[model samples]
Target: MNLIGKKIKIRNFDENDLGQFLELVQDKNNHKLAGLEYTNDIEFGRDLLDMYRRRDGSYTVALQDNNKMIGIIELNKRGESTELLLTREIGFVIDKKFRNQGYAKEAVQLMLEYGFNDLQLTEVWASTEKDNLAPQKLLERLEFKYIYEADQTLPYTGQHNLVKYYLLKK
Candidate 1:
């Protein structure tokens, strides 16, 4: 499925997206900010393909004109708790080259529409590093209320980082 925005398109990952996916992850800044470890292995790409094939609710944000994937955005369940199903955490990563463009905002707005209108979700949340002003600004521009400040575990780095949480109610 595809979610169309003004200048970007959000769609599911497939084999054809492997190269772009690798490029997205290989960027050092992305790894640092997102706290994700990337490997230059075909198995990793296969794993991502399998993930998309599982029909999980995630999408790759791409440019409309060239169909070049520039980022990723998704609303993911917080945990295994059934009560948390109505509340999903929103996450996104834009390529360095695409930063400062409005694509992230547009893609996120599309996901918000999908979550609230189509999924019937009640709330969406996001957390970002305190130093990451871009995402903080984007979330604020979308009117996500500041929820709290806390130490968040970095997935790849295995360290605690200062993070601020934001929430938007549907």
Candidate 2:
């Protein structure tokens, strides 16, 4: 799926995108915040390709006018069920150079539409660290309700404590 925005476009992740995707995932700051690191680009690329092959989730690339991969957005169902009550979670990561350009918000908005419309999800959820106020505020700007907080130990760093947010389709 391709979603066009005013300044960027969100589309399905392609095999050719592996290079940029690997670079983005390897960034220290991005990996620190996201709690995952890719030590082997080829292995990670294979896993991503497998996700695409299964059609179980969506991986979208945010592109600029010249078609640079500045960010990525993803939506995954909680389980195999198609029930409306089953939640879908959304996530995004923007290139450090492209920060504060509203690309994350724009890509997230388009993903939300796809999640609610095409995926038929009744609710969508997202989470961020307590210190990551940017995403929390963005979720609010998107009208996601402040659900609650939880203790989530980072899988990579073993850090605990995280705040989760949720939004229900009206």
Winning candidate number (TM-score) = 1
TM-score of 1: 0.88
The best candidate by lDDT is 1
Model 1 scores a C-alpha lDDT of 0.83
Model 2 Cα lDDT, one tens digit per residue, 1-170? 67888878887677677667667767877765754354456787668555654564555556657667777777866666557345788877888788898888888888888777776677888877677878888989999988888887768998776657566554
Prediction 2 global C-alpha lDDT: 0.73
Q: List the residue pairs that clash in candidate 1.
A: none
Give the Cα error of residue 84 in candidate 1, in Å.
1.8
Residue pairs clashing in model 2 are none
RMSD of each: 2.4, 3.0
Cα error, candidate 1, residue 78 (Å):
2.1
Evaluate model 2: give its TM-score.
0.80
